[model samples]
Target: MRRRDFLRTAAVFVSGASVSLSALEFLDPGKVLAAHPQLRWAFLVDTHKCVGCGFCVKACKIENDIPLDANVTRTWVERYVIKKNGETVMDCPKGALDGYTSKLLDQGKSGKVLVPDKEVAQAFFVPKLCNHCELPACVQVCPVGATYQTADGAVLVDRQWCIGCGYCIMGCPYGVRFFHPVERVADKCTFCYHRISKGGNTACAQACPFGARRIGNLRDPDDPVAKTVLNQRVGVLRDEYGTKPHVFYLGLNKEVR
Candidate 1:
């Protein structure tokens, strides 16, 4: 099917009021909640206070038991610090445990961190993962239907059905999805589906010391995500791609690549 057609069909399937177990039994609601007559969850990451901390990254690796050398990062932070000469720079240490250490080390042994010319200029860290787009590219490109998007705006991979084709990896515009060298299957952030459906928050959001990450139902006006999006001028990455990503960035920097 064409990418647009697939996205439309998937959205309709998820927006349904109820889904039969027989149709969804192959899917693990615990592993990836489907669209049902219930709540939906969305996430928001505040760039204003992220501080490039890799705590969330560490938590994801430890909680999921992902290998230390795996190039397929489920979640990671990118530090962007503009130089005084209008030279914009960015970096993400392969597996930095902490944001500060990664940023400081990026300056090399001299430890001369670059900054913008302005005395009180702004610099921010953006922790990126699967945006869980409403019209997910990964789902559209999955030949075996392994990658799917839940109604709650989460992009998930079915490891059992995955053929290790790596199609989703190429389809994802944000470069979030990756192939697990060991499992030989496609994997990405599930928005911690197991925890969110059971009245809990995602591990990354829960571990955030600055409360920079917030998860909530986008359909609910009272939810923090909804409120933030409504009140702030937030933006999603690669908006022109028409992916309709659910992850919103608060106080996004103009220098965001």
Candidate 2:
């Protein structure tokens, strides 16, 4: 079997066993408090430098041990290209799984091999993942109280308490929530809760080769993330949804569709 396939199988087995390993102890509660020293959690994604390599996706699956058949992708990359005059106009494929090889932009399509346009002057990639909202609708709409915002502002789900009602999935405006097929519960990015609370950055942020993703305490004025939000033209996805997400995007595509 391929290395990735092997890892997937192993992760499934490990996740199955982890279901009963002391919920409170499985993830260190104190680590979250110790990591930042301040009570805040936020992520920043820059659209300009993403290369669409899909490494983040692979890393997330390996790090979280998500099942292969499951569609509960915690992180993924999206490729968007704008065309005009029946020719390749602009393209930006800034995720880890970008299929860019070296072809005309017009030939780019879904699930097919994509080649970057050598002549195309503007093309980039954007990585998409859980925004970890501050006022997450998933947390608010959970009738069973399985989802809740942490002290650091990240929205988290308690698998042990979740009833698999799919309420959180429907409540999310950005469609970031997903139900795990094997676990039979709602799952989403915890900002690598296991890692973040342990004085380590999230897998996606660490996996990024170009430093496209940044995580830090929003409460700290001196932190890079906090300063960027204050000084940069940052944006959040679907802000009108009123979820008040903590994740911010920089250098967003003007023609993103």
Candidate 3:
């Protein structure tokens, strides 16, 4: 109750915490990564099947209890339009939350005919979320040891331990990590860790009306998703970065970053 007693207790608690963490510091994270168990998870996103409804985005925010802010997005959708002029433009205004509609445009007098939106060489919707890399850069760059992966292959941030230094955000090559709007801590999609761990579907996967997203366990011999991944040319984003992400995409093109 006294000031001196309170100070002494605080110092003891801090010292104990330091000692506790020092023990864990020697544990190799490479050991965490190198264990090639027969049980790992994966995700598939089919761009052709997604309608840009934004339901997945909405469901992700609601299920994760993330507030709606202009600057913050845990999941979002982008519309890619490749013009005939060999120019590509992508847009995701408001995360396509209201869904996409016809956009009015003016005709230009550049002597060459302008391509209409519907007549673009290519157009599709890509719903973006955490790639959940096998060798997550965010986890590697986390200075305070607040980010790590689980045994079943999900990357997560420890909210209580995170110091909000933004190192993980910078380390992510996929642009999936962000500083939470209210908490100001590193935040990202955990592939709905709580539900997935309990053998349930992710919010986005369940909310998707068209069945464009599929969650799969590579270890499962009878899973249809595993068969699909094996039969199709599944793609990973930024493969050159060597993140070795668990999430794969169907119909992914060079137009997307």
Best by lDDT: 3
Candidate 3, 195-231: lDDT as tens digits: 9889899999999999988788877878877777888
* Candidate 2 Cα errors over 4 Å, as ranges: 1-37, 85-121
Which model, 1 or 3, shows the larger lDDT?
A: 3
Give the lDDT ranking, best first.
3, 1, 2
Candidate 1 lDDT, 52-134, residue by residue in tens: 67889888877766776776678888877766666666667764455566334365555556443463244568888888887
Off by over 4 Å in 3: 1-34, 104-115
C-alpha TM-score for every candidate: 0.78, 0.74, 0.80
Worst window of 10 by summed lDDT in candidate 1: 114-123
RMSD of 2: 20.7
How does candidate 1 fare on TM-score? 0.78
Encode model 2's per-residue lDDT on 126-243: one tens digit a residue. Answer: 6777788767878888999899987677788898999999989998887778888777889888899899889898998898898888898887899999899888999888778887
- lDDT of every model, 2 decimals: 0.78, 0.75, 0.83
- Which one is best on TM-score? 3
Displacement of residue 195 (Cα, Å) in model 1 is 0.5
